[model samples]
Target chain A: MNPSLKLAWVVLLALELSFTQVWTVNVVLIVICLALMIWRRVAIKRLLWLTGVPLFFASALVWSLTLQGSASHHFLIVIFTRMFVYVYLGGLFTQTTDPLTLTRSLEQNAHLPAKFAYGFLAAFNLMPKIKAEVASIKAAALMRGQVLHVWSPQLYFKAILTAMHWSDQLSLAMVSHGFVEGAPRTHAAVIPLRHRDWWLTGGSLVLIQVGLFIGLP
Target chain B: MKAWHLRDIILVTILAIFMGVIFFVIGPVYTILSAALAPAGLQPLANEILLGIWVMAGPLAGFIIRIPGAATLGELLGAVVEMFLGGVWGASTLISGVVQGFGSELGFILTGYKRYNWLTLVISALTTTIVTFTWSLFKEGYASYHLGFLAMLFTVRFISVFLFGGVLTKLITNLLSRAHVVKNVR
Candidate 1:
């Protein structure tokens, strides 16, 4: 599936998930998402860790509600199932799609402007550099007899300064390379919107609606 | 609204990514706090308390860029980066970003995009509180709680949003101006 289409599907379903409280629908969606993740070979270890936090939280929520006698069993189930539905759906998108490909698809197919697309791509590509710069900033702070904790404004301030410097250099380089804002640009590869993308997206939408209708409280 | 220069776009993306790191750092804290509160049936309060920090990107980006949608874009991108960093929230992260960012943008919209002062920041915080709280009323099942509990949650969330989104953002922007890094928007 095209990355853009997958993102759209995930986002829309997440929105739908938020508005409704149907545990049966939630359960069905979770199972489907789990199946998709497994079929896609999303790393099981990472998926376990990723889903575990929500599982813990969901259990805690249900336990607390049970103890308080404030929520019904169905409500508890709804809350519990809702959390995993979100995680699995999200995990499916993140684990399956490459960020670079997503960006390219957004630019090529989603009408995302070249400026925002390339801008995001540039910064997205800079995660490692930003990490290194943050570490060096902390080290430099230690050398200067100033301890920069994670929540310290000085750490972010100094780090952002370096980031601003890099942004300046980066934009300069792009402009020098003839990267014009709002200009038509060619792509090395095309991310076509296949018929299957539409079929999957539409099918999921209809299925979720049907599930919602059937599970109406 | 001025057309976004390539520099502006890059700057927002980088700063948002940086904010994402901060959000990631806060994730564990939120989990610990939520876990601690779970026994008391107050797990949701943990989100109320820490939500302000999560919203910092919207106001911070709005203040720096002084553009119409900068806050929304910054926040949305911040959520993207967080998800990229393996946040546990999944697809909800992006939706949360949209809600939060729109809330922050409302403050700037109310000001007609002219002011970038304490008032603007405070209003942004207030609007974010109202907007996000409204979202919670539906999404987080706040409607099920007692009115008093809901009121208490709202108050805590307001304070959290004010301190982090308003005051902390001011401090960062202040530092940037003092260092002659970003062109002073004020």
Candidate 2:
């Protein structure tokens, strides 16, 4: 499956999911999400946390939504079902895909501008290291008798300064490697989007329509 | 350098990654806060407050980079980072990011990207809250509510975004400016 297409499908279903008022439609979508989770062999504990976040948040809206009558109650349920399904799809995507690969896929598949695409990818490469960098910076500050509080503005300022220094060196390296601005770049590999991906996309749309039909009054 | 320089990209990325980690930390707190507030029917308000913090990166990026569309790009990239870290909102986060980012970016655009002052930042954050809340009312069907209830939602959402996303963002940026780290940025 093309990653971008998968993103489109998830986003589309989520749009449908939000407006879906029919209980049966909501149930069907939830079931599909659960099936995906099981098939992917995601641990039950992790699945609980993944789905739990949205569920907890949605529960808060129930009081406000259900204030008047059973209509609001029904709406609340539909919203819960949507959140579960949406979280599952999002979790699955992020869990399975690599960020750098995602940027590359965007560049080739979506024709995202090269400067923006590679620039984002370069940033993605730096994401995992931010924590270590912050820690080291904090340690140095501590050694120098500079107290840093988590909520303090100084903490973030320090972090950005450190990151900016790294970015300066990085941009120079990128330029040195002959990455020119406004220049066309070619992909060494462009994978084909399979027929199955299209089938899934179409099938999901149909399912969503059927859900709306059954679920809405 | 042009408006969207390589350094700006790197800065946005760094800010995005940093904010993503912050969201991860806040996720559980948000859940707990929402649940605690649900009984008072302020859960929605709590949700808005939590979102205010998330939206800050846009204005922060915009103020620091002082470029066209910097806020929107920063917010979008931050959303991507959140999704990467398995944020609970899923695909919805991307939509929220775009809407909220563009919404916040409006304040900067209105100022001709010349004023990164307190008032502009506050307006930027409030604009984000207004934009996102309006969309939520439409999408979540809050139109079913009474006028009083609707007003309450609007007020809470504004305050939350104003304090956290708007004011806090300016505070952090000001600190950065004082430290002279962003000297080369603008």
Candidate 3:
């Protein structure tokens, strides 16, 4: 199967699994993806970084338990399981779908304005650049004898400032490129929802509705 | 008018992912820290403060974008990212995002969507703070907390909003406005 088609199925299955709250869906997906990564000879380090999400959720659960009253064991299990599933599925979507295809699909299918869609796309593409800029800023501060720690409110403030600066530059670049509101657009690539796409989407929605009606408390 | 470009789409996707990671990591940490470290009998107050912070995101987004649905969409995007990154709140994050976004949207709407002044920001803060905290009171079972605790929480939240969400967001937007980028886009 084409990776895109498989992606559609994965998305549908994820949506269905979300409704039922059967967290095994996430576990299976993660395992399969891991297996595939190994098969494809993908880097272990990159895969490990992706697993950071689960660690994050675990920390959150521990924090929540400490701060809030002890939740039922069952509830904790459900929450953690769902978190794994949700994050992994989301990660899979990003990993599988190219940003351009995703945005093009949204614009073509949803009738979104070309400008807004592009603006949104621009924001996504800027993420790496933003990260690089933030790293440079932190390094510069460190060279000046400032320690940048996540716990420090000053660090947060600096991040906000960096984001704002980047956004300002991004908007200017967009305008210079003639990205006007309500503009007509011509795409270099066309993203059509094939028969398999419709089937996957429909199947997922149906399964979710059924699961909600039957399984939800 | 030029159409949507491949680069723009890529940017938004990356931004969403970045925001997803940040919100996912920070949101739960913030919630837990506030709930844990807040003085005993101050949970309600903490809830209020958190809600106030949550509400501020919308007005801040709106102030920066000045576009219809900017507040709601931006807040929603943030929430969605948080959820995608597997926050402790699960799907409820989406619900909170919508309500909080609406609260901020009400403030912008009340200003006839024309002004992004300090008064508008204050109103936005109040609107989001009230609605969000009210929701939190129910969601977190804050009804068990004492009245005094609730009052303290509200006060702390008011201060937090004024300082963090209100003042800080406005300052950032102002800087952006002066950067010639906002002027050019407008």
Candidate 4:
């Protein structure tokens, strides 16, 4: 499926699940997403950690509900399954879709501006450099007898100061490379929204509604 | 807003990407905190406590760029970065980004997008607290909590938002300016 369609499907279902607490639908969604993730060869360890941690927390939530008796059993179930639903739904997207493809699809198919899209792509490519810079900043701070924790402002200030410098140089390079603002350009990789993606998205959405109408829960 | 220079766009993306890394680092802390709070039925507090930090990019970007949609763009891009970095929230991160960014943007809009000061940052934090809290009321089922609990959550959220989004944003911006690092952007 195209990234845009996949994103739309997941986001729509998340919004739907938020408003309604249908555990049956949640179960179906979870099973399908889990299957996809497994088939896609998502690392078993990461999958287990993702779902297992949430499972532990969900059980705690149910236990708290039982002790408090504030909400009913059904609501507890809804909350419990909703956690898995969100995690799996999110995992399906992040695991299945490549970030570069997603950005290209968003820009070409979803009308995202090229400036923002290419800007993101540039920064995304620079992530490794930025990460190294962050480490060096911490090392430099330590050398200066200063301990910069993750939440330290000095750490961010030093890192962002470097970022400001990189951005200026990067933007200048992009412009000198004949990149014009707001001009349409040809794509080296055309991320087209195929008909199958729409069919799958529409078909699943309709199937879910039909099942819901027939009282799947 | 004037036409966005390619430099401005790159600057904002870099800044947002940086904040996204911070958010990613903090993600595990939030997860552990929320799981710990779950047993006490206080998981919501985890979000409230960290929301200010989460919304930091919006106001900080707005202050630096000083454009019409810079706050929203910065926040939305930050969420995008978070997702690409394998954030657990996945697609829903985009939704939260839109809501949080719009909330932050509202503050600057109220100031006519001219005054980038403490007052604007405070207003941005206030709006972010209220907006995200309201979103939780519907999305996270915060409406089910008791009135006193809700009030307490709101207060904590506001304080957190003010401290990180408002106060910390100002501090960082000041530090950047003092070092003469971001003089070219403005």
Candidate 5:
């Protein structure tokens, strides 16, 4: 499937899950996501960790729902459901879609600016490097016998400056290679709008409509 | 570099992506903070207070880029990048980005983009906190809470934005300026 289509699906499901308060519809939606994860061979342990951490933090929410129940308890459930479903869908889409494919799909299909799209993809690529820069900054701070507090403003300031340096360097390199902001570009992959795309989109719409119809009561 | 140059795009993208990562990192911090306060029935306020820090991305972008829409682009790009990185809130993340970005954008706009001072930073932070609180009133059902509780939430959140988002971001921006990092973009 085109990453854009998957992105659309994720966007739709997330919006649908947002206000869906009915337990039955929520369960159905979550179940569908869980099934997809299993089909994709995503580790059950991964899913457990994803769900467990949030639930652990929100233990008070569970306590309130069970003990100090109120009308807004339903709202709580709906919001949590929205959170979990979004995580699952987002995880699925991101895991399957590479940055190149995403940029290509976005440029061809979504009409995003080439320079901007590629610029973003380059930034995404730099994420791992940014993490490394942060680590080296910490290491250097430690070498100097300065106890680098992770939560301290100094650490953030240093990290951002390092990232900015890298960004400036990379921008120059990209420019040297003939990248123009408003210039035209070509795509390697032709993203076709196929039957499955329609099936996924149309099916999601129908399910969301049904969910809303049942959830409103 | 001229205004809106390739360098500007690079700075915005990198900052946005960095903010996206920061947003992810803060998730755990927020969870822990809120959980700690859950026993005291201050969980709602905990998230809001910490949320002040999230506003830093917008103002910091505006401060360095010194361009119209820098704050909003920083915020919106961060949201989109976060969603791409599997943010749990999904599309609502985009909504929050737009709202929060607009709040800071209003701050820069009100000053005619002339002043990049502390007052403008505080205004940016306050605007973000107010909009998020109002958004919570409907989206998170804060309207159902007692008036006293809501007021407390607002107060704590205001202090939080003032400190973390406003003061801390301003400090960091100043540090960058001193380090010559700001010159690359400015």
Candidate 6:
């Protein structure tokens, strides 16, 4: 099993254990996942982008705190901690888990429709390529002395144009490759739940449930 | 499609789950958790205001998907993702998600779901603001805050929505369009 897939199952178990209570534990789990990703040699820049999302929210909370009186400051702190952890966990999971494995697991275990799943899988696979295209577009624009300011409406319009182009090509490619709805296909690999995966999932669940019970009034 | 090819079924399911996890769980949960932890009274108004802004995601989704129930489904999916991942508000997050999506969808519906103009975006922002604020009144006890505080919350929320959901989402969709990822959907 891929290490990232292992991490995702662990996080999912932790989430299920919490039974929809106290987000702090989930946040901690996210941080642990991020550490593991770094250990596994993922690029620092990508990690930074993932972590940066939570930071943006944190800044909003900070701004809110300054404006309002600090009555719920303690509550806010706890929330921020959880948010940061969970976001990183999500980032790590995506970075490490292969989309192919993820798709297979969802189909076999969760009973999702193949047509929708495959379409999305294709879309996910295309994300990196789409990103590269965006970069090239920006670079080309820059060469023509176009300022790529995010705040500008022109930049926004240009981005939409680029996305539409990519989607069209991708859709056409899929159709040409016999990826039509209802087509018969064989699985490339099976996503089995190993002993390690089960143990990790169970352990995370037990720990979370115990913590929540202890914390509750 | 046809009795469901195992490979295709699995692939699509995973993709949906992944997208669900990324958009619904990661984004909103992060925002909600951060808002919940800020220093007490100091953050409530601003946090609520920010929540209003985040809620505009529904209308933005509608604009992109342009399908019936797209806004509602997208927002609800996002909320469910957040809840499953452990949001601070617990079940209450789901309630907010429904109301916010409804509010945004109303704007789209009023525009006949055809126009993606600035007016429609502004209406979407206002609709989200009003609906989300109404929910906060019940959940957060709006009676606790002064009139001035409430006004500030509304203003900040409007500005946030205009900038983030309206401006940022537009920018993202535009990029997607140029790449030909969202063709003929507008």
Which one wins on TM-score?
A: 1
DockQ of each: 0.62, 0.55, 0.16, 0.53, 0.43, 0.16
lDDT of 2 by residue, A92-169 (tens): 777666776677777777777787877787777877688777677668889999876545576677777776787788
Model 2 spans > 4 angstroms off: A67-71, A139-150, A210-217, B1-3, B179-186
lDDT of 4 by residue, A78-194 (tens): 888987888888889988889889889999999988988888788779887877777788799899899987567887787677777898999889989998889988999998788
At residue B28, candidate 1 shows an lDDT of 75
Q: Write the per-residue lDDT of candidate 5 for residues A93-199, one digit (tens) a residue.
A: 66567768877888888787777777777777888876676678768888989776534677778767766787789888998998878887765668776898879
Rank all candidate structures by their lDDT, best first, as comma-separated numbers.
1, 4, 2, 5, 3, 6
Interface RMSD of 1: 2.0
Error of 5 at A179 (Å): 1.9
lDDT per residue (tens digit) for residues B45-120 in model 4: 7778888888889998888888789999999989878877766777668888988999999999999987767888
Segments of candidate 3 deviating more than 4 angstroms: A1-80, A132-184, A215-217, B1-57, B76-100, B130-162, B173-186
lDDT of 1 by residue, B75-176 (tens): 999999888887878689999999999999999999899888888899999999999988877676666666777788899999999988988888888888
Quote each prediction's TM-score. Answer: 0.95, 0.88, 0.60, 0.92, 0.85, 0.57
Residues A1-217 of candidate 6: C-alpha lDDT, one tens digit per residue: 5443454454554344323345456565666777788887888887776677667655565455445533255455554554465556555555566556766787665656666566556655655554455567668888999866534445445544444445566667777887766656677776776788767666866776786567642
TM-score of chain A in every predicted structure: 0.94, 0.83, 0.61, 0.92, 0.83, 0.61
Cα lDDT of model 2 by residue, B43-103, tens digit: 7666766677788788878877788888899898888888777676778888888888999
> What is the C-alpha local distance difference test score of candidate 3?
0.58
TM-score between predicted and true chain B, model 5:
0.88
Provide fnat values for all models in the order shown.
0.61, 0.55, 0.09, 0.50, 0.37, 0.11
Give a tens-digit lDDT track for model 3, residues B79-112. 6555434343433566667777887887888887
Residue pairs with backbone overlap in model 2: A22-A215
Candidate maximizing lDDT: 1
Checking candidate 1 for backbone clashes, the offending pairs are none
Residue A41 accuracy (lDDT) in model 2: 82
- After superposition, the stretches of candidate 4 with alpha carbons farther than 4 Å from their true spots are A60-69, A212-217, B180-186
lDDT of candidate 3 over A1-217, digit per residue (tens): 2334544555555445544444344455557656755665655665665577556544454344435444555445555565565455555544555546756777776677776667676776665665665577669789999976433344444555555556667777877878766667788887776787668667755765664466443
Name the docking class for model 5.
acceptable
C-alpha root-mean-square deviation, candidate 6: 8.4
Task: Please identify which of the two predictions, 5 or 6, would achieve the higher TM-score against the true structure.
Answer: 5
